[model samples]
Target: MPPLSMPSIPQSAEPAASRHAAPVAKNRRGLETRERVLAVTRGLISAHGYAEVTLDQISAEAGVAKSSLLWHFGSKEMLLAEAATSLFRQIGEELGAEPHHGRTAARRLENSFDRVADYLTANPEAKGVVLALLFSGSVPASVREEIRRGWDSHVQDLVAALSAPGRPLPAPMARLMIATIHGCYCHWYASDRSEPIAAFLAPARELFADWLRSRDR
Candidate 1:
């Protein structure tokens, strides 16, 4: 499999006039304020879960006014959606930055596992935010749909990379691989870093590799 690269989120069609209008570029300060709001949202969601987090808390923690938050993101749901999308995009870019090195497909899969383990280890809060969103029951349907779209994009990329000539991987198998990867991360997180994430993922990695080899045979 090649390096994993996620597809961009699909945007809705804009009005003809809006499409023709010049894009308003944000200044450095505006950009920074936007990022600060996003960062604060992610942190709060990771620590308290999406259902428990409030716009007031984010505004206070980010040192931005509530009106500014609304101005940047329009609504709470949009803010959370953008935050999750940004995290997924960041992960995809980092994964795509380095090429996987291995002699065989199975080995390449293991290499990808290593890369994920390293990334999650470095960005534990990312795992927290993702899992929190996944398990939360109170997320708005619109927000949940956005998250699903981002997740499906990631899964589609992995499935494409893992498929062989004239043989596409089943979407379910791709989902299984992703679930196992997150399961390993959950265990490692629960253990409080007592065990390395790589160790937690090793068995599942080998299992996936074996399954891939079986299909090839």
Candidate 2:
């Protein structure tokens, strides 16, 4: 009774597989749900504009519970911003990854532009989301950084391509060229064309040349 000692219980190690099994399954399910929500959210926002898309609509279109979407993304504004950020990243990757082909470097650059044109034509929302975010300025700071990072990567690819054997393109020139291509897509979109989008590629190189000459000053 003068001194009572308590016994210590040793911890036991459970099987690593057993410990991780449930969590892994849960994580995979969560990721799938999140991706579904994000994809649906981007589609709605791009098609209807950020100001018009709502959480309820996203939930319905994604076939997710509204509560689940709120839990995953917090708010409609946050979801839209995240979606725009994602769309921007996708475009940047496409631009940077477009395969270079043709005998000469200049021809290869033009071929790269061909890929860009195809991408823009196939995914109108890629341009729409960027334009919306640029004009709206409602995207979160973190999302904006993601967008800038993507374009910065794209710039590197363009710079490498443009700085060829005889021709050297400045970073500013690359940026201008990209902007001109974007303008072409915008024009095509504004025209409401039912014809082949590839047709709009006609004057893109000439447009880029005009911009490049003006940039010489």
Candidate 3:
């Protein structure tokens, strides 16, 4: 997959003459405004899928002029792309914060699930946007590809965490584990966050533990 695109303003969007001119520095307030716009975009997109969201809605909610969004992000596509990129980066950071620790692979795997549950609890918007993008047919191909890459990265991380000295965990098994966790998240979100995500993950955790024991025997 291609490297995830960074959220830089496109130079091509600038006037021809201004393209070669020195870039003007943004003041603290200007930076704050840009961040505020991004925050609003993420929240809206998370609450409502990408296709359902519009520049006008984002502008109104963000309290910035529509023209200002164009000035900062160049276009709606760029803004959404940047927002998706930012969300993926945040997920990666949160999941990668500490190595999973346990005496056995099964225990380590459980710890990993706990970490995910904690992350989902702290950032429901993140979970909402992720599920929305994954299941939505209306999401752009570029955005879908970004989500795929992010998902693949998490799968690889789990594979590594579950692997042992002479016993490497199969990628498929790792994917199943991820899918199970995502299923838990899906149920939790579908229920309007009525139950904790950890509650939904409990059965899968037990099932995995049993599977690991069978493999050991």
Candidate 4:
């Protein structure tokens, strides 16, 4: 089958209008170019470490001119910033496995965490980007800040979920859970993900259940 051009992505994935943002293309070909660059970015970054994947390789692999790469993305840093956001948003979509109604807040949180853990296991390239940009001091400071922002939205979403009533979780605890989840993610990937990634999320689920029991008692 022929490749689809510009398939709908989450609204949060839209490229920004500013130079620091993903290239905002207007024309059909222009949009296609951006998609190709992002695909190559994800693929190569997954195969190699984030710092090792360069714009020269992305441009060559995506079949776009080096100048075209620049025309779409002001710099490689900006491209990776956008690609990280894109990958994260894709993971968010993966978390929405079931209908919200009839699901307990703890169950929902568990599912979301499980989804994130599983995603990192499956997409090692994107995981490498997370490790290099967020964990390792390999990227420029400006890019590091951008990568941090990319991680915040989903965490904020998790915080919102934790705040739901009926033994609502405290914000501090929600933040702690998310922080721990990130730590586990680092450990899981660093160890080659030998075991199921969701195994790391079991503690968060247990915590939520413990809180629920306390509230019921």
Candidate 5:
């Protein structure tokens, strides 16, 4: 019987590391490029209005090849829709959940409205998205639908936040109130009026406060 030679210990995973790092680096680059594409799309839509934006422009603004843009998003229309969808999601992210503890719903509503006003005031550039959907109605029906759905969700949250715990306002009035708040926001963006949305909401806020006080009766 002959003794078998001991096998040499395998070296450090440097080869595996080098091989794996390439794909990992490629993935990171892909993610960065994808993010750049979305950012450029958002900015272009924000600045030029969605209807006027083109894939060529988005590609140029993103610094990615136009073919790569197509590879990422398929087409300009899809990219636009996705961009609008993302923007709404971003809005929802900012909204968080309705605060239901400690404070009355009306107070919560007022606080939320203030937050919204501050957001719109600060991001005037994104006002185009709001105005286009609310007033222009010029975007594709699908995009409008997407905005409509997002608006419905946010408004419903407002209604829930404004409702009395067990004695909620009737759906009709709740819907109307939500519309009024949206109208308030639209007025700010569409007309650029400096009436102060926060101030404009004051009367309604007081009305809601009064209603909350009277919920038992």
Candidate 6:
């Protein structure tokens, strides 16, 4: 008798479905956990410096497991970096949305300062973070680098907007214009002012406006 032919074993769709569903489920959980961890980290690190912050503290503050926080950020430095990056990105979005979007370098330059002033007013903790980074030597180099990169990118954008075609201002002067705004904020943060932040920003705004117009001309 001939050997019986073996029947072909067909693959089940169930395994493929399970495999696909597994990653989606995991990713969704991961994103949810990450959001929670970042939320907790921002509150903690903003109120307290990085040195005082720890994974256990974040987990307890966030109501998440320590392992979960670890899975999300891998380390405390990474978490702080994300928070600072988020802050810069928020400011960038507000600045980019201004009437300066399509305007000339001069107008864009003016709007840049105006938008950042508005951001500082709304998010005063941002001022604290800036001061901490500048004055406090304890902040991680990675955090400082992140802020520097953000500042560079923001200046480049203002330059591009201000330097349109034949009317473009010199890069160094444009940078000076941008740096002036940064200096104003830094000074305000450093002062023991009895007045509101708005008061300090008023003169700086006027100065930036005049500088933009004169430089563009």
Question: Per-residue error at 109 for model 6, in Å?
Answer: 3.5
Better of 4 and 5 by TM-score: 4
The candidate, 1 or 2, that scores higher on lDDT is: 1
What's model 4's lDDT at 42? 80
Q: By lDDT, who's the top model here?
A: 1
lDDT of 2 by residue, 109-213 (tens): 566677676666555666666566655666666555655665676677677655554556778867776677777777788887776556776677756645544
Please list the residue runs of candidate 1 whose C-alpha ends up more than 4 Å from where it truly belongs after superposition: 1-65, 72-81, 93-104
Using Cα atoms with residue i matched to residue i, what is each candidate's TM-score against the true structure?
0.66, 0.62, 0.61, 0.69, 0.60, 0.64
How are the candidates ranked when ordered by lDDT, highest leading?
1, 3, 4, 2, 5, 6
lDDT of 1: 0.74
lDDT of 6 at 201: 69
- Largest TM-score belongs to which candidate? 4
**Candidate 6, which segments miss by more than 4 Å at Cα?**
1-39, 45-54, 61-64, 68-74, 97-107, 130-141, 160-178
Question: For residues 29-133, could you state the per-residue lDDT of candidate 6 as single tens digits?
Answer: 878777777667777765676558788888788788877666766656656666655665665666556664457565665566666766666555554555466
Superposition TM-score, candidate 1 onto the true structure: 0.66
Candidate 4: Cα lDDT at 21: 42
Residues 32-81, model 1: lDDT tens digits: 88888888887887777666878999999999999978887777876877
Report the lDDT tens digits of candidate 4 across residue range 72-137.
677787787777667667655555445667766767766666667666666655645655565555
State the TM-score for model 5.
0.60
TM-score of 2: 0.62
Candidate 6 has a TM-score of 0.64
Model 3 per-residue lDDT tens digits across residues 1-217: 9999989987678886676455443366687787788788877876786668899999999899999898877767657766755654555455456555545777776776777777667556565566666667776676667667777877777666667667778889878987887788778888977788899999999898778766755
- Model 4 superposed RMSD (Cα): 12.1
